[model samples]
Target: MSPHDQHETPGIDLARLRPWFAEAVPQARAEALSATLITGGKSNLTYRLSDGGSSWILRRPPLGHVLATAHDMGREYAVMAALADLHAVDPDAVGLGGFGRPQSFLTRQVARWRKQLAASYTRDLPDAVTLHAALEERATAADAASRPGIVHGDFRLDNVLVDGDDRLRAVIDWEMATVGDPVTDLALMLLYTRLARLVGPEIAPTPPTSSARRRSSPGTRPAAAATSATWASTWASRPSSSPRSSRASTSATWADRPSAPASTASVAERSTWTWATVSSPKGGGQWVGPGQDRVLALIEEVGLSTFKTYVDGKSIYLRGGKRQTFAGAVPPMKPSALADFQRLAVKLEEMASTVPLDAPWSAPRAVEWDSTTFGQWLDANAATDEAKWLFTLAFTVIQGEDPHLSSLLLILFHIAGCGGIEHMISTTGGSQESRVVGGTQRISQEPAKRLGKRVVLSSPVTEIRRQDRGVLVKSERVTVRCKRVIVAMSPADAGRIRFTPHLPVRRATLQRRWHNGTESKLFAVYDKPFWRDAGFSGSAMTDLPVARFVVDNSPPDGSVGILLTFMGTAGSGPGLTWSDAVLDDPRARRDALLADLTKLFGPKAAHPVRHLEQDWAREPWISGRVSTRPPGLMTQYTDAVSRPVGRIHWAGTETATVYDGYLEGAVRAGERVAKEVGAAL
Candidate 1:
């Protein structure tokens, strides 16, 4: 065959391989070399090179398509070179300190498959999403419990070269080799044995038959038993094929395929409570959480209530220091003031709607939006001070910051395309509509109950030190070591903890600059929903300095009446401010709050059986309620806020992409970080 005219091996260049091989192996010389493609290997291509006198094997990535991290020729070569010293090899003794990042290697492997699966998604198949999710959930603990070693990513009969006597010869196909839990290699080997039963013995190798081989295999029964039903279903779900080529090929098998669903759907799709579609982020999916609200689905799977049932079309707002009862979110404004506010709201909404939730902070439109503050936008658009005050009252409570100091991009994120604040609250089912059945506290307590003794109480972590293999977390009562740590508090609170090696300058700056909004909640409990009896929804938005907004926190049965007050000090210029004297004294604060309630609800609001106040600023662990960003801060370090610094990951309401200052944002951030840490584990 002419080297130029006829090419048998698809990826191998005959003309180039001959001279290159001669140079690589200088002792071996040949005028012409013949190459033949080797079959059986699925991921990286293998070829047999013969110069008549000597033969050698050559491997390369498969032709047409390649999965990320699945094919690394250099990594394959490194593993082979490192294993050459196995007879007397000590990874540290050989100066291979940076050989591979062993920390969270198994978790990374699981996450790698998840991302690759999402990238190569075609159509949904049974057990694909479920199996992948289960693996991710368990990956962290699995990595923590295991020892790290060079993992042969794919360890099976086809990838190994054996002698005629069936004795070991050499292990090939090192493309997927990496520093990870060595048990993965054992698991995959055993899984292949299991696959033989599902795909038939012809396609997969049989289990060990010889006594020596059987004995060498580490207690086969328990390992196979531990593989679980998910592993079995993983093997039986779908055929291995390239979605891009749509060709039947075992290049990627059911045993090793990605399992994430292709579609970008959200929690609303699976929610039992009706979620308004307009309130959803741009892609109709949450900015965080598993692809289709799987994190939320897990909460439900654990038997926790996600949302509550509420009477439809019931809302109230306080305007001009008057109690105005409204069916929806239309806060009572003077006719001219309302008209002026609409014009400004429409202008800001138009600009904000252009920025999608998933758009990069550095995107052109995003950059433009961040270029100005909400105050700047209002200054240019609002015709009257009343219009500006209306904007302030609505957004300040939602965002937990003075609008002048907030990026226009931030304000737009909440109100974009949903009209302004009024439309977002009422038409979109609003943020304030639903309450968790028992209270939000149940969400945290339920998980702790399941964890039992593992969940340590009164152990507040004060320091996190990065060790060579993992992190050491020191708390008041206990110290723990982990491969990866997720800091779920606000950036401001995280600043209180000492980091041994210290954080990157950009990240440290973010923590230092992450200021909190001084916000507090006050709840008044009464015998009945008396405000409801007067044809009021028991919800009010007030311009009062002490009580900013009020909502009905009654049980579904309406057995007791509870009015929850959201109070905060806002504004840099002359706008609204919380009374410091009232906040300092409990009795004075209660008196002032009740007085405001009396003005809004009537004389019946004067007495309450119980009044509970939560001043977030006074909390030891939490210095403030929600995080607020200054005008230019987000533009400078938007990516750095959530980006992992080595083994540490950031999670909190502030780190979320959608609803960044709300409880929903906190849940989403937790979900996002859980997946992030799980992947690395």
Candidate 2:
């Protein structure tokens, strides 16, 4: 079938299967097979193979669409199926019981929490800095003083069951349990004080004299239960305290992959492109190093065809969802974009390999990848100026800056292996990293618990003055001495702080030059998501000046619906000029947003019960969603922005090397700066 063919049989090749099935599974050789087409579409096509008496399941690649390793039938059926069976077996059989490694486990848990929180810092959280600063003294102390042993991470009453005789039936779910501080498990049980709140069937109260509470399943259940109760017995009364990129740290390789040949099959991915191949005999160079092995494994895991995402013109087709045909100038732009994507893919792979991610200017091929502005990069490769505008404008919304060519490359390479451009373009519905539910406030909870009374919430530090061998942190009615100080706010807010001795010229100049990218979230509140009934997936993008992206942020419980439209910086979005009063007026902003929304989503959108706007330009502490450098500014100040000045250090998402403008970057930057300050102290 041609790549353009819409008709599909989804029928299994019964003749081709006769020998292959016999080879793979000898038991199936005796059956004379017949197949029926069950279903087929963009995903895997299925067929029911029968031999009159019994049937077998068959699955194969879709006729036109294939997602490389994403739809791996081999791993899906062979490797995972067997591994899942093994996992279902008894845990004690695999020596999971009494896997005691106390200090190591607690230490790793704390480190993991810090790392996860760091990734979640898409926005600024200054309290997180104050909390993290006190964490080492607080979060780690509980581990050292407690008795280390086996503990269930969540020892809930609902996780257990009792029979009619009031006998212990089974103890299940050991996922969170491990050998660590046993006291923590008791803490979770104590927190679940309300018996009515249990997720399992209500258990009859055990008589004070009953020994039946000790019975459980398997050979190890009796011992496990006794140990748990024994550990819990000493924990009735206790004290409490709390809480909380590689490259840019994904192992996915763009520069590296298994260079293997593709079959001359009719599948769209392998049909046209002649993939360059290399042979590594039976035993190639040991697949060496932690970094190297991980890179190759990531390449294989994501699949060889992942790099060919641009080979088909499906980028637009996929992102458009049901609205496959483009209207107006979009159709014209689509043609040039397809060819550009193909060229960009090849060029990106070269850049991914040659460019040094952390310091692009230091790359041996910096002249090609980094020594140019992003506009220059586009013009050099693009066949037309319109192509340049299309990409440059889109990138402006993504990166928030256009100073260095590497900024463009950073966003490009990050999404290169993400299957296709559709995902990168579909900016609605949020992302996996957006799970930080309570916004920046989520960043403060753990820190508040750990820091306790030490966390001064409302006090604003008025002056940071240097004293002999220490610094004076002065706020309302307070003056505190600290050996080291970390300014975790934006460079703009940090600039508001008066440095008594004054920062070095380079540091001061950096603070003045770093600019926050302008952005506004046009949030519309609705009674319910009306778009779903109209077959809309709640995601859309457009070239219109009013809103480039619109997202359906419906509450999970269907209580209300919210739509967020954007007015990105770089003079894009809602066609509003940067006049102070025009941008500041809430009513004007709301009406204009409703008018634009009515054009896109119809009259229902115009009648939103409430409209909320968060212009980053108007936020007290944050002036922009991300920080960006002007044309010539980075070369002068890149090195000095994050440099430790005397006892002061800088940290924020913009300072990150990976996911630079994202929340993940902020968390990473926080951790890095915290370490830098800790070392000096």
Candidate 3:
């Protein structure tokens, strides 16, 4: 019986099975048997043998000439027995025929085919010779002591059957199984997964290539020979056979099977590809380290390309590539206002550079200013100070006028004492508290509690939509449904969350127009608070540092504390020794920062206890500092910022037009959104 003969063989008739059933098992008389040819094997014939009441699988060697070492039915039976005893095989699934039981008709046919196939092909043929060589190599490797196992030569999806629920019902065709290196099984499984997409659920009858056949043919058994050599060497050092115990140990090989879920399978496949690529000598080894090499090897073996593709597609670099150029190209400067703003920007930069390196009033100070007094200070200093002037200019360019300095000042004067100036004076006059300006109490610390809880932090949310019963927050995690969500984030964060049932077009439009003030903040903790004693306040608006303004963080008790600094705009560039490249390097970042601090606060500020920096550009959750509108955003999006979208409402600093990027804006947005949600509920 050749391979073709096995396929063409007629199945046993159920009607004629009565006599066989009477002799074999009288209880099986009521059962009928139907044989269906199973596909997916190159070296074996497998069939689904269904009795009237139950189904069983039959497996045997392929039709035609077979190699001496190929299609070992005994080895297959041993592996199945081990797996079954371990309960690794699903109980609902059937197993191979028991030892001593009469073989099924299908099995007899398969044996006949194996005999025929063995004689059909000659060793002279190139394909046959290659196939034999491959098998020899595999057998030699399998025989190595360290690689001992009952190897499953082929374990592709097509060889396995699943029930309606997608549970593995049976694994068929074990003719190529052998007691040898277990890694052979792993290699076969990996190969199967790679070819699965193209080959479908069934295993293909042909080898991947002639070379593969030579490497994998059973008679050659090169892997087995290698395994045997290793085993012999080990035994030479400490002699022991212990065949039974060694066979029992093979059960541990299947331990990994149950955990091999579909997702894991996909990841495994991708890892295999990545490993192959990286391990290839053509790819430079410069980037390969010990850990990375191991990872690449595993990835190659497992074929992890799919997972890698998914991750790369969602990275910040790809997502922000196009948007990063927006600020440079657009400049956010209107055509009519471009010249004036450009001139003001230059003047402000020059004035900032000319400011004294040391100043008494420049240090960080506590201020308790009413809105009116703050407004008065702004009015008095707006024109003289370059920083304030540039701010006002930018505001005027974006907004038609500065309402805070104009209309809001009058309101503040009526309600409190004087306008912005008086308010600033009052706040500055307040007694200095502990050095740290914004303590833990002032900042939300909820994140601290969620640590180590599988939190998905830092990933930017692309969109949010409302579901039937709850809201869906979509991040890298699949859509998460939440009944109540705290949008206690930035306005930019709020704007990005897409709502379902459509947020009113007005609200969506408002969100796009609102801007989170893009500013950079830096904090440097020095060895001691030395600047205060030198009559130099910690705060200064200077061109020496990247930040336009710095705050003195010296404690009243004289302990070393943090000095906070802020860049008024995103385009400050680098200050002193701080180049763009240095700022990006973690170690250089701190050094560059300290270099600037020393310039402003004198030599004593050269070394800091710690350095902390924040770049709003790369921060996903809070893309920018707070909301700073272009001149007209307030009139446009102010009313709609906190408006409700069906049951969902918006909240964040950007949503608050009154104090857009300030802490006050956050509070305002929160209060307003809470009320809106309350009303909806």
State each model's C-alpha RMSD to the native: 24.9, 28.6, 24.2
Between candidates 2 and 3, name the one with more favorable TM-score. Answer: 2
- Return whichever of 1 and 2 wins on TM-score: 1
**Per-residue lDDT over 596-629 for candidate 1, one digit per residue giving the tens place of the 0 to 100 score:** 8888778878888777765555444565655666
Model 2 residue 299 CA deviation in Å: 28
> Local distance difference test, per candidate?
0.59, 0.46, 0.38
Clashing pairs for predicted structure model 1, backbone only: 107-681, 318-541
Which prediction has more favorable lDDT, 1 or 3? 1
- Identify the superior model by lDDT, candidate 1 or candidate 2: 1
Q: Considering TM-score, where higher is better, how would the candidates rank from best to worst?
A: 1, 2, 3
For residue 118, model 1's alpha carbon misses the true position, in angstroms, by 61
- Which stretches of candidate 1 lie above 4 Å from their native place? 1-299, 306-318, 321-323, 365-372, 416-424, 570-572
Lowest lDDT block of 10, candidate 1:
275-284
Candidate with best lDDT: 1
Q: How far does residue 184 in candidate 2 sit from its true spot (Å)? A: 48
**Per-prediction TM-score, please?**
0.54, 0.47, 0.37
Error of 3 at 558 (Å): 4.7
Point out where model 3 deviates above 4 Å: 1-438, 446-463, 467-486, 543-547, 554-558, 568-596, 656-660
Output the TM-score of candidate 1: 0.54
